[model samples]
Target: MGTNICVTFFAFLCLIALSNAQTQFLRWCVISEAEQKKCQDLKKVAASMYANRVPSYEVIPLIECVLGKDVYNCMEKIQDNDADIMALDTGQAYFGGRYYNMMPFLAEKYSPGGAGTGTGDGMNYYAVIVAKRGSQFNVFQLQDKRACFPGVGTAAGWLYPIGEFVKKNGQTNIMQVTECNAIVKTATNFFKSMCLPGALTSFYNPFGNNPARICELCSGFLEKKCSTDDPFAGYDGAFKCMSEDAGDVAFLRHDTVAQMAMNSSYMPDNYELLCPNGMRVPVTDYMTCNYGSIPANTVMTSSLKTKPEVDVYKNFLLKAAQWFGPSGQYRNQFDMFSSQPWGYFNRRNLLFTDSTQTLVDVGEKNTYYSWVDNDFYQIMEYHNACPLITARLCVISKQEKKKCEKMMMAFNAKDLRPSLDCIKGKGTDDCMKLISKGDADMVMLDPGDVYLAGKKYGLEPFVVEDYGNMNASVHVVAVARKRDHYMTLFNLKKKRACLPGIGRGDGWIIPMNIFIETEQFIPQHCTLFENLGQLFIHSCIPGAMDKDYNPNQKPVSLCEGCAAGGFRKCQRTSEDQYFSSSGAFRCLTEKGGDIAFVKHLTVRGNTDGRRQSYWARNRRSDDYELMCKDGRRTHIDDWENCHLGQIPASAMVTAKYKSEQDRTIFWQLLNYGQQFFSSDIEGDFHLFDSGTWYNDLIFSDDAVRLMRLDKSMQDYRNYLGQDFINKVENLHKYTCVPVKPSKKSSSSHTSISLLLLAAIFILQLVV
Candidate 1:
C-alpha cells in the first residue's frame, strides 16, 4: 500500500506539471504543421497552435498555447492558421456563437468553449443580406424626424442596417455639402469608421448561385439577378463607386436571429423567413427551428476610454456590418488593416497620425515601389516615399561638381556652363564649395534654375542653306528647331513668371519648394517671346538736319504731319483689320515704313556726362522722354535712349567686327540675328528684337515663311530671308547679346575672370 501511494503521487506530479505548462502559456495561438515543425526544429517551446477553437478566439486556450514560452513574434504563425481554417469554411464552427454555446459542454462538464459541440454547422458564421437594393437611402438632407427601426430579429436582421443609417446621418451635423466627390468621400469615411466587416465581391454578378469574384463594373441596384454576396472578402476596394454598383444598398450585420429585428439605428434588417426558393412565408416564420442561435464570434475587445475604437478594431460584428454598408465598399476593403505587421500609412506616406495609432519607422527613402500598384507590405517594408528620392538640383550641382538645375517652372534639365572658377583649369573644380564649407543647406536648386541657366548656355550657331521656296523667293539661311531647345526657351519664360513647368516637353518641371501652380502649355506658348528685332529706325531726321530743326528741338513738319502726339490711329499690321496694344503687335504692313504712322521720338535725362539720342539736324537733343518740342511723349510709342554712347550704323561693321568681343556679339546677330546697322549714320534709332511700329514682330505669315525655309528648324540662320535679314536694325537688343564663351563658367575662380575682363577694358580706355 505504501509503494502504490508513492507511485500515485509521482504520476500526480507529472499531471500538475503539464497543466501548469499549458495554463501559463503566453498570448497568440497559432496552428500550422509547417510552422509547428519550424518551431520544434527551432527548439521553440513557447509557440503552439490550439485546436480547441476554430477562430482561435478562445482566449484562455490561446493563452495556454504559448504559456511560459520565451519567443518574440507569433502573429504570422497565427494569421496563416486563420487563412487555413477560413479556407476550409469551418471558421464559423469556431468563431460563431454556437461555438460559444458549446464551449461549456466541450468536456461534457461545462467545458470552456471547445469543438465538442456537434450541433452547429456554421450557419451563423457571418449572416448577411442579399437584396438588389439594400436598405436604399442616399442620406438626404437632415430633417427633424426620429428614425424608425423595426424591432425584433428577422432572418436578415437590423442592428448593422440601423447602425449604418445613423452613421450616415452623423455627418449632417458637421457641415452642409453637396457634390459627387464630397458625397463619395463622406461615404467612404463613414464606411471605414462605422461599417462592419463582411464580403460583397461580385455581388452584382451572379454565378453558380453565388459570385465568381468581386465586380468592378457593369453592376446596378434593384435587380435580383444582379446582386449576390461576398464582395468584402478581400482588401481590394479599387472598385468603390465603380459605375454605381452599390449606389442604393445599406448592408447590415447582426449578432443573432433574435437581435436581427430589434429596432435601433444600429440593428440588422430581418424580413419574414423564407419558405422555399427564397419565397416569404409569414406563417412559417414561427413554425420550424429555422432561426437558429448565431455562434458567438471569437473576438477580443479592450476598453477604449477616451475614444471609441474604429469599426475595423471592433469584434466580428463590425466586420459583418462592413459588407452591408451603403457603398458595400467595406467588405473586401476592410481586411484587418490594423493587424498588419507594419502600421498603416496614408497618401502622405507618413506613419501614424498620432501616438495613439502606434507605429515605428523602419526603412525610409531607400524603400520605394518600382511601380504605382506595388504591394502594401512592400511599401511598409520601406515607408512610401511620396516626396520621393529625386535629384535635388542644388545638391546635384554641388555633388557632381557641375551646375545642375531643372528649369524652375519645368522639369527640363539645365545646361551647365563650363567652369571659369576652376583654379589652374582643374577638371570640373569643386563647384559646391559653399555646401562643403557648411554655408548652405544643400537643398535642390531653384526650379527656375533651368530657365536662368539659359544665361549660361552658349549661343552655338549652325550653318545651312536652301530649305525651300517662300513668296516666290529661294532663300539661303540657317534654321533650327530642336523641340527641346524651343521648349527650354519657353520654360525659361514660365520660370521667369515663377510658374510651375508648362506642358510642352516630354516631362514637366516643378520647383523644389512644392509649389504646383502651373500654367499649362504656358511653357510652350511662351516661345512666342523669341528674339525677332527692330525693322526700322523711326528717329530719322525728317528731310536732313537744318537750322530750323535743331538737335535740341522737335521736327515741326515731321511732328505735325506724322511724328506728332500720342493718340494716332494705326493698324497692328496692314493685314490686321484693327489695332492692338503696342505690346505684342506684329507689324507686317508697308515693310520698313510702318514707323512712319507717327513720329517716334526719344529722350535722355543725361544723368551721366554722356547722354545718347536719335535725331536729324531738325530735332531737339535735350529731350529725355519721347516728348515733342511741345513737351509731350509722342504716339509713335516705340522709342528708347541709348544708355551707352551712341554709334550710327556699322560703317565700322567690319571695323567693329574686328575684335573677338565684337565678333562674338556681332556674329550672334549675323548668324541667327534680326538686328543690323544702317548704311546711313544719321538714321540711328534702335529697335527691339520684335514688336511695335519701330520694332519687327514676326507675323504668322513671316514665321510660316521662315519655317518653310527650315524643314526642321535645326538651323535658324538658314531660315531668315534677305527681307528678314536686311530689315534688322542696330538698335535691336538681339543685335548685341554677349556670347557666353564656352570655355568659361562661374564655377571657375571668380576673381580671375573679373581681372581678365577688366584688363581688356583698361587697355581700351587707355588707348
Candidate 2:
C-alpha cells in the first residue's frame, strides 16, 4: 500500500510540473500542421542563436487551422487569449486594433532585393498612383478612367490614394450616405474599368448580396474569385493589369514599379507617377511623387496580459531581431523570418521587415489610430459609416477678425469640428463675459482671469493648455541673479521686486497667497498701499502703471520702480520692459529689481538671451539660479524638488450652469480638435497660431492634451484660501478676516487634503 501511494504522488508531481512549463514559454500560434513543424524547427534555431549565453526566451507552437484570407480570425484568437502573437497585414492590423481590441507592438522591416530593406530611417513607404508614361492624365482626370488596385484595404495600394481622391472630390461625408458601399460606389462611378482583387470576395464585398458589377472588372479564373493567391492580385499583379493594357492606371506601393523592373517581363521606363497635386513625374521619382508614408504591419498582442508578461514577450521578439540581423553571427545559420517555414503566410518574405528594425510599442486597443494619418483615419471613418461629429468653436476676437476667419478656413481644410466660429469680443475680458453669458460656448483665459471667471462669473475650467515641457500647472517661482544670496520666500521680504501686473496670478495673487499662508504678513497688517511699498524696498507693477488699471484704484507706491519717465515705465504694453513674464524676468536680468516673481518658464526662456526681443537676446542663462526652500540655490531644472508652489495653466472655460450633456459635448469638441490638429502633419491648421497678431489663440502652441481640471486645480485654489480669493473678488481690503487656523484644525485639513489627493490619483490610474 505504501509503494502504490508513492507512485500516485510522483505522477501528480509530474502533472503540476508540466502545467508550470506550459505557462513559462510563449505560445506562438501557427495556422497549419506544416507551419507548426516549422515553429518547432525555429525553436532549435533560436536556441542556437543564444548558445553563447543564457537564453532569455522560450516559444512553443500552438497549432490552429486557418486560411490566409481569414487573418481576422487569428486576430480574434489573440483577443480571446487563445493565441499570443501573429504578424498581420497593415489593414488587418488596423481592423484588429480598432474593432477586435488587439495590440500591435512590432512591425516587419524588409530589405529590398540584396541591400537593406526600406530607408532604415524610421519612415514607412508611400502609396504611388502610376500610369503609362505616354498617358496624358493627372489624378483629377480619373473620371471614367480605368483603374487597378493591388487589393482592397491595403494601406499603400488602395486606402491612401483612394482617400486622397475622395477628399479632393469633397466626398468626405460619403460615409453618412453609404457604409462600406461608400468606397465601392464612389470608385465604381469614378472609374470606367478596374481590377481590384478582393473587392468582390466576401472578405471585402458582400457575397452575392451586393451589386453584380462590383466584380465585373475583376479578371478571375473559373469560380476562383479575387483571391490574393491569384498571380494578378498584388503589386506585381496590379502592374501586370496596367502593362497588359487591361487598365489605364494602377494604385500600388511606391517601390512596386522599381521592384518589377528587375523582372524580364517588366520595364520601369514605361510608367510615370500621378502626383496628388495634378502633376506627373517619372515612376523612378516616386519618392517625391507618392502619397505620404503609411505605417508598417505589426505583430500584435491583447491588452489582457500583465506588464511583466508583456515585457517578456517584447524582449523575446527584440532579441530575435537582433540575433537574426545581417551583421549578427547567427544570420548565416538561420533565416528565422523566411516564408519557407510558414506555409500560409501572406508574402514570400520574412515574417518581419526584410532586415530587423526596432520594435515600437503601439500600445493596446484603439490608440493605434495615431500610426495611421488623421486624413486616412477620417476617410476610414467615413468609409466605415461612423458618424462625423462637428462642434462649433467660439473664437473670441477683437481686431484680428480676418485672421480668425483665415484660421477657421485652415481648420475646416483639416475637417476638425465643432468648427471654430469667430465671435467678436471687445477684449480678452469681454470674451470671458461672452462665454459666461451664453453668447459664446468657450474661450481660453490666462490663469488669473480663469480664476476670476470660475469664482465670480459662473464659469468652470474644463481643459488647461500646456506650454513648453511643463504640465498643466506651472510653478510660480521667485527669480534672483546668481550674485544675490537668498533662501526661502522669507528672504524676499523688504527686497526690490518686479511683477508683471497687480492682477496677474503668477505676479500677485499666488505670491500674496504664499505670503499669507506662510504667516509672514497679512493684508490687515497694511491699511494703505504704503504698506506694500514698505513690504518691498521698491517695486515695479506694470498693471498699476496705468492709474485706472489698479483694483484698489490707487497707484500709490506700486509704480515707484517704474522705467523712469519714459512711456515704457510701468506700462502694460509689450514694449514695456516689465510687461509680461518675459518682461518681468528681463526686469530682474537687467538689474531693475533684486528679485522677480514670475512663472517658472520665464527664467529659463530669457537666461543667456534666448528671447526673441531685442532687449533679452543676449542674456546668459548662467547668470541666474533658482532659490530653493532649504535656503540653497540650484539649477533651474531642479525646481520641482525645490522652490515656489505650482499654479494652474490657462484654461478653456464654459458656463457652469449648462446641462451635463451640453458640458460633455463641449469638452468632447475641444478634445477632438486638439487630437487632430496637434500632430506635426496638421501644421496647416495652427490651433495655436504663433504667427498671428494675437500672442496665443484658443490654446498654447505647445499644448499636447486637455485634461479635466479636477482636484489639482482645487488644491491650487485652496492654497490661495477662500478669504484671499474673496478679497481678490471684492477688489477691496478686508477689515475682519478669520484668524489663522489652530494646529489641530490645520492637521485635520492636511489629512483631508492628502486623502482627496490620493483619491484623485486613484481615479486617474483607473482611467
Compared with the true structure, all predictions reach lDDT values of 0.21, 0.59
User: What is the C-alpha lDDT profile of model 2 across 660-711, one tens digit per residue?
Assistant: 5555555645554455455344355555543422223455433555765553
Which model scores highest in TM-score? 2
TM-score of each: 0.18, 0.43
The positional error of residue 450 in candidate 2, measured at the CA in angstroms, is: 2.1
Worst 10 residues of 1 by lDDT: 346-355
Root-mean-square deviation of each candidate, in angstroms? 30.2, 21.4
Evaluate residue 706 in candidate 1 and report its C-alpha lDDT on the 0 to 100 scale: 19
lDDT of 1 at 482: 21
